[model samples]
Target: MNDTAYTELVMVREFKVSPEKLFDAWIDPVMMRKWLMSMEATNKSASSDPRVGGLWEIIDVRGGKEYRAVGRYLEIDRPIKLVFTFQMPQFSEFEDTITVNIKATEEGCKMVFTQHIRVPVEENWTDEDTRRAVEEFHDSSQHGWHYMFVGLKMLAEEGITPVMPPASE
Candidate 1:
């Protein structure tokens, strides 16, 4: 519960679509499934109610395994902002808060996404291995989000659904 255990990841992207369209792509399962999740994820479902306190979940099937993220909405401001709690279904102890802000531009719209996550570091927080693991986790998290956001922009702006990568053999 020390301040040193928290992690914050932020990403911003501009799209050739309005805030409304970009926002809808986030809460509508039909549009979301077209872009969300890794390229290898299949049989995916993104169900959500775009209102405060409503629950949302994303489930994806990969190689006969199901992975899911379930969360509850905290705020919904159409075409502008949304805040929510995000968590993995199997990892009750690990949860994060995500906030997305959208602003309209003469050209299109801009989105700023922020996720604040807390990692549970053991009592000896100064250990080298633990520090390295945390660093690696942050790097991977940043990389993953950047990749996914590109897909989202493509879907929203171009109406192009990127093909899902084939499942591994």
Candidate 2:
């Protein structure tokens, strides 16, 4: 068995908002919940402190089961960049880092998310295996992030929140 495993996935999205406002939403839990929650019907599953060495925790419930990701903030540069660790409590074996970069464009904001996953060598690391894993993560994350941004745009334009279906429903 191999001793280590690694994978990287990157996703990008453009939003019709200024970089500063978009950046603030990323760091502020209150604002983050408006878009980050898995279910639009509920509030954020947990809280996060957007500072170096701070903790980020979220408890998401689906089908009456709870899922969590707990980690520490490694870097936080407002309106520009953020890097943090990610861990799953259930498996306890998956630990990773996620970095978000925000750049301002003439028309709006360009946000890029990069997720790095490191796994045990026992886990399959074939080319196909790696490609599938990264593709899955990239697809799911892109969808979620796009949804979040859409919700954010609606909030910004109308001062109203968008509703999403519950995972249970």
Candidate 3:
């Protein structure tokens, strides 16, 4: 199957901080490395220009495997919106676009994060094993982002850093 498809995933979460504070964490490299990674991963580094047309790269060591996400900022509006393109070098076959919109509330803020990603299915690579692997990768990415969202909320709200293996346990 030469089937090509792009999947969109949306994750919404509320933060106990202002929109500006929550948005800043995503652009500031210092705060980014602290919460933009999966709990199971240790951040190797996060560096970004954080302006329109600027590029960013985040390296994380997950499951003892190095995972790299490189992207460019397409749009930026402080405390409001941010749009970026995401790509994984190892999976150069796929591409992703991410949009983050923040709305300030009486207490804090609500963030609507959307990711539109190309679902990778290489031509002539259709087999039971290959199909399973592709599905697993998609699900893994979904969970990773949701986990990062929780970590971000904690960092912005209670100033608590998410330690590996989850602190609640």
Candidate 4:
């Protein structure tokens, strides 16, 4: 981990909803199922343990294959802040830490989300190659996060009710 080059990705968004409502969208499994996965994902499901050190996971199907977002909670400060470890095992072996800070505003709330990514460069790669790789990785990740945030915003502002899947026998 010491040798890894960490990249920080930060995003901020304001919502027209109470801090508690916005924060609840992150920890509650049903809300997570609706907003945590990529926009193209389907059959999304989530399970959570929101206390510090508790593990949470969300799985979504895309093209008939599953992609997961798994994490362990590191900090939980109610409607104010949350810190967790985020991992996508199907994509990479490295883990990242995500911090989400929320503050109440006159109209609603503002959220600052940050992800610290552990980007490992191969020794044999040229500097230009390393730069390109990291940029591409971050770009894709940022795009995905933007999509998820759109869903969050919709959930907050429009109260879009998620159509939950039927119970499996």
Candidate of highest TM-score: 4
Which residue pairs collide in model 4, if any? none
* Model 4: per-residue Cα lDDT over 33-94, one tens digit each: 77787432373679899999999999888778888989999999999999999999988789
Q: Which lDDT tens digits does candidate 2 get at residues 1-169?
A: 5555566767787777788887777667766666664534555366887779999776766667777768889988888998988887696566788898989888788989888866545455777776665666556655665666577766654555677632321
The local distance difference test score of model 4 is 0.83
Per-candidate TM equals 0.86, 0.76, 0.84, 0.90
Task: List, residue by residue over 49-106, the lDDT tens digit for candidate 3.
Answer: 9999999888989778988888999999998999998888976655689999999988
Off by over 4 Å in 3: 1-3, 39-41, 124-138, 165-169
Instruction: Give me the runs in candidate 2 sitting further than 4 Å from their true place.
Output: 119-160, 165-169
Model 1 residue 128 lDDT?
A: 77
Least lDDT summed over 10 consecutive residues: which range in candidate 4? 160-169
Better of 2 and 4 by TM-score: 4
Tens-digit lDDT string for candidate 1 (1-169): 3324667888888999989999998898788777666532473788888789998888878788888877889999998999998887565467789999999988999899998876667665667756675776677777867767877877888877767642222
**Backbone clash total, candidate 2:** 0
lDDT of each: 0.78, 0.71, 0.81, 0.83
Choose the strongest candidate by lDDT: 4
Candidate 3 lDDT score at position 116: 82
Please give the lDDT score at residue 5 for candidate 3.
54
Pairs clashing within candidate 2: none
Stronger candidate by TM-score (2 vs 3): 3
